[model samples]
Target chain A: MAHIQLPEGLPGIRGAMAFRPATARPLNDLVEILLHAPNSLTPAERELIATYVSSENDCYYCQTIHGAVAAASLNGDEALVKQVKHDFHNAAISEKLKTLLVIAGKVQRGGKHVTTEDVTAALAQGATDIEIHDTVLIAAAFCMFNRYVDGLATIQPRDEAMYRERGKWIARDGYVNVSKEYLPAEVAR
Target chain B: MPHIKLPEGFAGISSGFVYRPETAKPMRELAHVLLHEPSTLTPAERELIATYVSTQNDCYFCQTSHASAAAAHLANDWGLVEQVKHNYERAPVSEKLKALLTIAGKVQQGGKHVTSEDVAKAREQGATDLEIHDTVLIAAAFCMFNRYVDGLATWQPEDPEMYAKMGQHLATEGYLAPSIKA
Candidate 1:
């Protein structure tokens, strides 16, 4: 049960956006760019970053959903996702990613916390400028995302399986189509 | 002149870490994984995503530093960083990245804003599950980062030139080395 009044069967921020498609479209458009954009990092990696941050923020819905997506993408390697959530440094991943995640973590805390030395370490580990940029952006963007979802008091399913199912659909279709059924009639205005 | 009081001559997060090395190690380690780790997405692309998100959040320090870093890595394409900061969709980037940015933005606003279809769209644009996952994590993490910096009242430099200079050093030496006088 959510603390706020929200539509039934519609969990998380989707419910809020459905109530207002006028805002949803633009919002969706922005999401499209961040996740699917052609960059060096893979979609799964980006999602993992989100999951890790959500876990830290204690945004149950975001963490579960993204964790499922990451698990599914990593060939059902849900454990890796869990490892990252519990302790990213110990998680089985490349050094470069480790470096990037360190930066990401700092970004999660604050950009100022990110030092020139941090960038230097990442660069030494093979982090390009773009990677550093994306890491920061991902951290910055999720802050907004987490706040938006939590702020609206959206419903979050307690079942982990639910997120797994949702993640599969997301891995297949995309938010635009998933959002169609949730859109309110008044949104056309 | 910075609006806040950071320890004297702090080049980046690492210098702060040095002040308290024991606690800083974990934070630094996490950041390293998030930013430098190899993934399906290119480093440049990832940086751009971070820069754009920071810009949207209006975290001045993040926007400037990350933007400069992105600019440095993108072959002096500071314009792209600016464009993305202002409006990512209108910026020069791939369709896949554009889609990812959409998701990143949603994550920034709140994770629930992201939908299965958003992931699907990213896939359609050739985003793997990993890419999608990383995007979400990055966005979520940045939210924490923004709050931490703003929460602590960290200093933010106003000069664009300073950022550029910092970018050059970062591009060359990375985040761990401080070439600037601070």
Candidate 2:
């Protein structure tokens, strides 16, 4: 049971966002622009950053749902998503992404954890300025998402199928409308 | 100096947001909604959450900038703001705000650190569901904001006046305005 009276079925951010649609509007907009907007970083790669940060924060719901999204987007490569979490250094992702992940991980631990050498290494790996910026933003954003969901004590369903389904939904349709569809009737207003 | 060649003279997130206005739009809007829009918690209280979380993260840019905003909103109560940041438990804020700050601190350490007992304690202090929700969100969001500013090694001016000016701008016009009012 959630600490608050969030809707029973909706999970993680969905329920928490539903709890306050005003905040949801901008949050979903930010997620949509950050993840789905056309950019050098593929949506799969971006979702992986979000997943990795959530995993570090130990927010089960965020990591699972985003892991599923990364998997669905990567031709259903759930194994690849797991690899990125376990040891992204060994994952099949490119050297550039590996470097980006290093930066993201540092940010996950603490902002000051990232150093000048990390940026130099990432630039050496061919990550553009915006790619590095977005990677940091993506990682930073998930810390908030992770904290918001768990801090609220929203119901975090462990059923694998549920996450897989939500993952496919977000990966396919994206976040803006998905937020609206999932909101409780009164809150949706 | 920012790791990226962001426009110079812009402070902290100002430089980064300019570097990527596409990302900045929603981020600024999110800030407005979370801290500016109508809520059970006062804007000062919300700004305090952001400032306190930044202090915990040791992000000098975020902590100072937001402390200014909190103080500006509270009749330039810089002393009050510092007291809350140093020791919120004994600070002059309402009991409800103290409880919410407890949850915010846990979120800063890491999200899972916040427990159900914390939530119950907050509710006992008369925090509404929305107040609890906003408190966590403010803390969580500041973590992101603090990291975004510091991750790239964005430049932060050392002068307190700069932060006071930025703080006054944010408190007066809110985050929906362009961060660089100068």
Candidate 3:
């Protein structure tokens, strides 16, 4: 039961997005350009940053859905996604990603928490300005997004398979101008 | 000084925007739509919500800049803007805005902090679904923007007059192509 009367059977943010498509347009556009746009960061790496931040916020729906997206882009390696979420510092990833995650982690805690040294460290790891910029924005945006989805108590399906299917679809096609049917009235049997 | 090499002479978030126009475009559009677009809520009231949340976050740049904008919309009522930021519960604003501010406060703490009781109170005070929705989004979005500004440690002008001029521009011109050229 969401605070607003969103369209039925549209889980999570989609229902809320449809409730006010005006705001949704810019939000979706930001995600498309920020995450899917051409850049040095791979889709999996970028999705990993979003997932890690959501996990830190304890947003179950965001973590699960974004984790599915990361894994879908990573040849269905769910275990790696789990590892990155739970213990990313020790996970098998590039030092550069680990450093970016550290910066992302600080942004999730609080903006002021990110120190000058953190930026310098990322630069040492060969991260470009846009890479660092997108990392911070992604973490910050997810903070807002996680709050929106949870604040309204949007419908979140407990079943894991649901995210897997949606994950593949989003990874295959970018986030811009997708069919509303992405959130089908009936979950496919 | 910002961690990134933003252009010189621009203060706070504007410099950051100039540095990264790609992200800035959508961000500016979101701010315009949320705060400046025609709505049931007055521009003053909407800017007040942004100011209040930034105040709670202790973001000097966001709070003062938006407070100036709120003041410009409120017939240059800087005193009222200060009251709303420090003690909105007792501020001279309508009951509707106070109710919305409470929800905004809870959002600054965390998303799940907003309880059903909070939403109910705003509705009870004549807030529509659109107002409530916009309130929540405004609060949530400011958190992102404040963090973006502060996270990078963007340079902020210490002079209050600088922000006053900036606010007049924002109140008059809206968020796109802002003239922080001072």
Candidate 4:
């Protein structure tokens, strides 16, 4: 039901990337750095940020997929994921995380919405510069991702099971395996 | 000098928020849900996503403040911040985060750029459904934030020292602090 003429059975951004691998590589590379590189923040936390932003934008594909990913990583705790989506502050998280989410919310609305005080709260709660930097990046990046997915009118699966299954695979293989270069052209189609 | 005016000595989003407290509240509430709420992912990681997206969108205020916040909580490594901003893949992070950033980048450009495989890749890297959802939300929100700030032409301080100092203050006080709230 996407606005464009993408191949049938195409789920999310992957199909679009397959259609244009050249553009996909750089995009993939960027994700590798921001989400998977190496530092203090865990993968689960990073993914949560994406889900939070997607939910705000009402991008069904992103919200469902990331929600599944978060659930899988949290030992299949879908309820916690749902709770966070409904309300982060009330969710059982650390003070530092609460503060960071505050800032993330600001970023989602507009960078200018964030304040020095917001940064101060995170730091007080033990957030580091790198963590802060990454948070902003994550929020900023998702803005683009949401638009990209929603903009193209990509096919968003209605099945929650599909997302859970895919989340398991992602938790195991990482993004490279799913790359168009690795998958057969027909599967990509 | 910002293209728009509110009050003197104001900087970044806080300043703008102060000018219009009522309108800013909803946005703040939305950000709170997107970021602070717990899930499989950590707050630090979530903040990093926000910073990355802001940087991609060229939102100076967001890039600086969130970067500072991330640094304060996670690593406190300004170098890493610069590295991610310049090139995230080369930056020091984990495999899973790298995958998430990939999706975030696409979000910055447009959501259509993301793929099912992208979600799969992120999931393969241990990204959960909430993680993926948060990633998209972060990207989408930043777009709105970037445009909001840029559209209004909010104040942006050129001094790095100023931001560093501001970062320290922000690290100490929450966004709801009297200084920040209008």
Maximum-lDDT candidate: 2
DockQ for each candidate? 0.10, 0.79, 0.72, 0.12
lDDT tens per residue, model 3, B32-74 = 9999989999999999999999988888999999999999999
Number of the top DockQ candidate: 2
Error of 4 at B66 (Å): 24
Q: Which pairs of residues collide in model 2?
A: none
Give model 1's DockQ, 2 decimals.
Answer: 0.10
Residue A121, model 2: lDDT of 95
lDDT of 4: 0.69
Q: For model 1, give the interface RMSD.
A: 12.7
List ranges where model 3 is wrong by over 4 Å.
A179-189
Question: Which residue runs of candidate 4 sit more than 4 Å off their true CA positions?
Answer: A180-189, B1-182
lDDT of 4 by residue, B22-107 (tens): 43554565555565545567666767888898887788888887778667666578887777777888887887888888888887
Interface RMSD of each: 12.7, 1.1, 1.0, 12.4
> After superposing candidate 2, which stretches have Cα over 4 Å from the reference?
A184-189
lDDT tens digits, residues B1-182, model 1? Answer: 22223466664443334443433433433334455555678767777787877777777776677778778888988778878877888877999999989888877765557776776788899987556655665665556555545433455557778788877775556544343566
Docking class of 4: incorrect
